[model samples]
Target: MIAAAWLFGVGGAILVGIGGFFRLARPALLPEDLRYLRRTPDEIDAAVPSLRGWLRLVFIVLGGYAVATGTLTIYLAATDIRNAESSAVAVLAVTGASSIGVMALVNFALHSTFRWPLSAAAALWIVATLMAVVS
Candidate 1:
């Protein structure tokens, strides 16, 4: 559980940093004088119609969920399970690390292409966590 918590926390932090960079900081940090060099007419047109406000809202929501998921794992580490012995902890560590790896891969892939699958990865994480809790 500790291992899972750590992996999830580190992964979530990286994701939050990425989301902040793209959704919150990048536009404001870009030089006003050099902005023209950053966009073609088509790019500018595409950007202009984008609902960035909505996108940022989504990022924030996902960020919150990531934080919660990571934190819950930390919380789990503090408790003993019903009928579980020392081996359960080791099993949890392996599962947690594996899940975090999967989550990271999904995130990396989504950054370049389809994003709907991110939700699927998140859903899997939630289901796996629930299984851990109940088992």
Candidate 2:
């Protein structure tokens, strides 16, 4: 149970750390994501300056969502999940699928630099879930 909790907490922390970086970083867009779009920042500005603001907004919201997800996972692991029953797993499963799972999927599809790390994060989450079940 302790291992399960620790694993879950670490997985959640990954999300929180990455999300916070995205939210706080000056670049707004991940360098890889910008590279994927085939536009340097200056090139983007040259093409459509307004686009940068929109991208910033998008990343800000996405980053906030990631942080919220991590926080929720940590809270559940710390407070309820240890003693939880089937319903707890259900909640966590659904939450992960909708957030981290989806993020990983999109990153993979785009061949983004985030893909492998996000996939590893998702794996941590998956292993943590399995540990919870067995523990």
Task: Please report the candidate that would top lDDT against the real structure.
Answer: 2
lDDT of 1 by residue, 1-135 (tens): 443344334444444454454444443212331243466545654766564456556666655654554555444444442334345445545544554546556545545232444444454445545554545
Runs off by more than 4 Å, candidate 1 = 1-48, 81-99, 110-135
Model 2 scores what on Cα lDDT?
0.79
Root-mean-square deviation (CA) per prediction: 9.1, 2.0
For residues 13-88, could you state the per-residue lDDT of candidate 2 as single tens digits? 8878877876878365567767688888888788887887887787788789889988988887786777655566
State the TM-score for model 1. 0.41
- Model 2: what TM-score? 0.84
Question: Where is the poorest 10-residue window by lDDT in model 2?
Answer: 26-35
Q: What is the number of residue pairs that collide in model 2?
A: 0
Per-model TM-score, in order, reads 0.41, 0.84
